[model samples]
Target chain A: MSGSARVLGVLGGMGPLAGATFMQRLTLLTPAERDQDHIPSILWSDPRVPDRTAARLAGGEDPLPWLLRGIAGLEAAGCGAIAIPCNTAHGWFEAMQEATSLPILHIVEAAADELLRLGITNGTVGLMATSGTLAMKLYQGRLAARGYECLVPAEEEMARLVMPAIELVKANRVADSYAPLAEIARRLVERGARAVVLGCTEIPLGIAAGPALPFPVADTIDALARASIAWAKPAG
Target chain B: MSGSARVLGVLGGMGPLAGATFMQRLTLLTPAERDQDHIPSILWSDPRVPDRTAARLAGGEDPLPWLLRGIAGLEAAGCGAIAIPCNTAHGWFEAMQEATSLPILHIVEAAADELLRLGITNGTVGLMATSGTLAMKLYQGRLAARGYECLVPAEEEMARLVMPAIELVKANRVADSYAPLAEIARRLVERGARAVVLGCTEIPLGIAAGPALPFPVADTIDALARASIAWAKPAG
Candidate 1:
């Protein structure tokens, strides 16, 4: 069960697109020849969970029941490792990781490990994600341990900038959604971020590869993709 | 079953990385809430196919047997459409498409469709792919129908340039793979591509928004992703 073919499972649908992005990342990450070399992946992309921000701030319905159902299904199907593609879902992820026997891939741990390997120092990584991810401090908590800092849009910038773009995704207005991000990327450069992590998987959907503002952007989803590939690869 | 989930089943692993890139493109292209909201995808990434270029030149093993099995699996699983990520594999795709009852989303056709939408004409589309894709009429034949002029690397350029990078990928030597592609891209721009299609999905992995490249690059995988999303949306 822990070997090839039945390797990875995902608990997703925090926004469906992030999970979709992560799965796509999985496909690209595997090195294969015909069409069966990929590790078989079972994904539960359930978007019905109550908003994480709402649940944490004001007492709202918990997503635990739905998340556990997703876990049980994947476990029943014999998955070895688990991953949650949502950045905001990390609040529950700690609980989920502890509950599941499967080694869950935490994006925070994955990104931090990559930063360590890259020798990323006092350097600030510009984070672009949801209000929940920013406010909840999922990545911030783990990154603080590794001595790396996470920079985000200020209160005014986040409201006028990031949130609007996320709205465009929820609405499926993809092209229209990108303009605000392009503008915000300009401001983030002026603020001196060494690199930007498209922390939200949906953000990459909006970004076209270009040097609009400053510094290279490392997509956190792409980071997770690389991490997953590393995990899936046969150990030397 | 056809009411939703276009279900683009992929027969891949001329190289697994290529399959992964295609999945990412599919996810990127689909418009959805959680990953499940997009098309249901079943990927069979087989990495044991003979070197496509070598097989084309000499009488060697073919990928047809493997391709058929994967496509059959997709059909049995209720996939509505199928796509293979390898440019080289497209040589046999027409045969595979005919074998399956489901529609096969041709990546070349999809790219041309996007070009028409983008209003690209008169300029050349730089094609970065495996030698087999060029030798066979995989992209050229379909692109001709769509009124696109394809610009592929010269055979000498293919040997001196692109193959080295592909080998690096097989060896797991990433980061170094980008330099060869960068050099090749500059040459293609000088010869005449207005924009380059990282025709091979893996090339985009190499070409991800880096320091402004020598030319404008449109990842076919990106186009594939965007188009698949469009295909999944119920027409308004």
Candidate 2:
């Protein structure tokens, strides 16, 4: 192997399962005939980092210090670039980027890139994320900048459908999460969304528990993995 | 989260998928209602480490320097203990343990512990692993020390069934690996083995791809995960 080869760093544990699944996806997605052909990676899964949504929406402990600590840990371990799998955690993307010279792959940017790759540029896209991500406009701002409009669930819908579904996944009741999440995505498509973006890390797991949705859904976990892969293998 | 909480380090990337799956298993197997309740882990998945089986069987590159490099990196990153998921890689376990104060969980010993946990204290247990592991006597010595006899595939079965099945998993052809592996496991059971140990990390994946094996199977991936989890949570 070349000494100059990039080692991908995953700053995860926003939800431990999401972090683990992202690592699994990264390994499965990479095209490798042998072990050495796959990406070299370091996953720092510190689930103790205070809740991202709680910090964003309510009066909760700030997770920025923990995020920075993880970044520092990865950098010290010789990571070339970093990828944070959690969608809501990207609320601190700028602060994290400012703290390190290493490039952090943005979950929102990767989702937007997925939208473009799916030929949905300049179209209205439905987004399913935590209430905090919606309140912070993480996807709305990024998608809007990329010429895509985001239609999100109403507050009542978030309370009744979205938030509980996310909790079910965190609690490992994935099969039960599918119904509520799928219903909301269907409602979004009915309200004129061309595609639905599974914005939160847990949302895709919920959606996948059921049969495939008829509508196009961009999974951010997969989107982030693809972005990490792209960054790992630059054109020769 | 307590500052004194243990951080589990994984020395992975013998084959990237196995390493990634181990992380998934670790997260899923842990008893956690939310992210904070899960274990904190660092996965150093540098797939570029030279082949362990090749090094053991043929005049191939020594992987000790690379193994030591990973151990050093994890130690520097604040890991309290380490777990290596690869069965073949443990051939250099003594050398690795000598280089680091951090406790590296032994996969073979973990398997032995798992066998006892399943109430199979002293009996004929079958082991399915890479040629290197068998050649190095990693499992035989350890299992014998634990008062258990291991029945392994004959040399012809190793070439015809076991090795190919393992390779299929490595090459991402998990579904195709099931039949051959199951046939061999059945043969072992017929030859007086009580239960089969899926000693190679990839074997469990292959077994899982097909219908459930009629015989009881000890999955080392899960064994290693359980061992890692046990180390992460100490009785108060």
Candidate 3:
């Protein structure tokens, strides 16, 4: 029917809150002056996808099939492209890409572009994400390729601070997540981090709950939103 | 694959911002303590659907076919039910319901339930909505079936206050929309309205831009969100 010519599909539900927030940000960040100017999108948020970290780190159930099913659903919905908001879920990025011909926007690349946009061109950028993401070096290898040194929380900090904060946000306890997340963020700054990349989709919401961070921070949700906008916009 | 058993389809994009906000409210309002506890949903937001007001009031292109296409897509994507957030768009509720076997949650019905929840069992309730929704009596007929007496803004008030405020919200000037909306809302209250139903999807966002209203208010976005949650929840 109408507006079906081009649609961006969002593969979400790694955690429902983060996925919904990504949709909201994508709508708000688009440079449209009217309703028609906004992007056409379909968000397929299924929260039952088994934990990405558990699948990646431990010998847990496979999530690739669930991810592929979502991609297939989005493709069947006539989406020209797809964007997945969850950072840990990106562990299946390559397999998902091969499963479908629709161009899937890369969240890590978007975060790297966001770092450049924030003028953190050549300094140590702190990363705050799930242990699965760190295990894969999703942000490390990409940011390093762009000439940026990346710093991540110590093992103890991730276990004590980062992971708990992420769980709080996922459990809908966003405000309670802010203190511990902000504490770890301050520790990163103390270690000479120029700025922090909120690498996980849920981390941005947790950090946003408290007072604004003194250090420059790039939210991966916002990064992915801008990337989605860029993909939706016609070339000049 | 994992959480795809019972997906809620949101037929949105009457105006992209309102639809996105509704999805966000749906996620936040759900009684979920964790990600998997939240509902599985697919939001098909296509802003290019011909304006419902233009189509209904001015003999413009029929948006029914476009609406049907979205519904079909959601069905194909394995959505067990549907929820359309826009009040004006709900003018086609019966036809949409006829088009699909999936149970579509009614925004007006949800608003009626919200009124009872807010202790407005028997009083004049003001309505703030698009002229198309007003013309179609989406709220008037439905709420009249209940005990509530409905009041609507006069023609001039809709033209000057309500309509422009809705446009400002769609155009993303949310903060700028608060004054005129509040003014008309105040006038409605002066005429003995116990509470106001923010009938149009965009109206809630416009009204939410400023300070909280001193009077009771019900937002259809939140109402629809609750309805979706109720549908997703297992029967006790």
Which candidate number has the best TM-score? 3
Q: What pairs collide in candidate 3?
A: none
lDDT per residue as tens, model 3, B1-236: 23435678999887888887887788778766777777888888998888888888899899888899999988877889999988888888899999999999999999999988888887799999998999998888789889888999999999988998898887788889999999999999999999999999888888887889999898999999988888888561
Q: How many steric clashes does model 3 contain?
A: 0
**How does model 3 score by TM-score?**
0.97
TM-score values for chain B across all models: 0.88, 0.96, 0.96
What would the TM-scores of all predictions be? 0.63, 0.96, 0.97
**Regions of model 3 farther than 4 Å from truth:** A1-4, B1-4
Q: Locate the minimum summed-lDDT window of 10 residues in model 3 chain B.
A: B1-10
Top-DockQ candidate index: 3
The TM-score obtained by model 1 is 0.63
Weakest ten-residue segment in model 1 chain B by summed lDDT:
B1-10
Q: lDDT-based ranking, best first?
A: 2, 3, 1
Off by over 4 Å in 2: none
What lDDT is reached at residue B184 by model 2?
92
Residue A32, model 1: Cα distance from true site in angstroms:
11
Q: List the residue pairs that clash in candidate 2.
A: none
Q: Order of all candidates by DockQ, from best down to worst?
A: 3, 2, 1
User: Compared with the real two-chain complex, what DockQ does model 2 have?
Assistant: 0.64
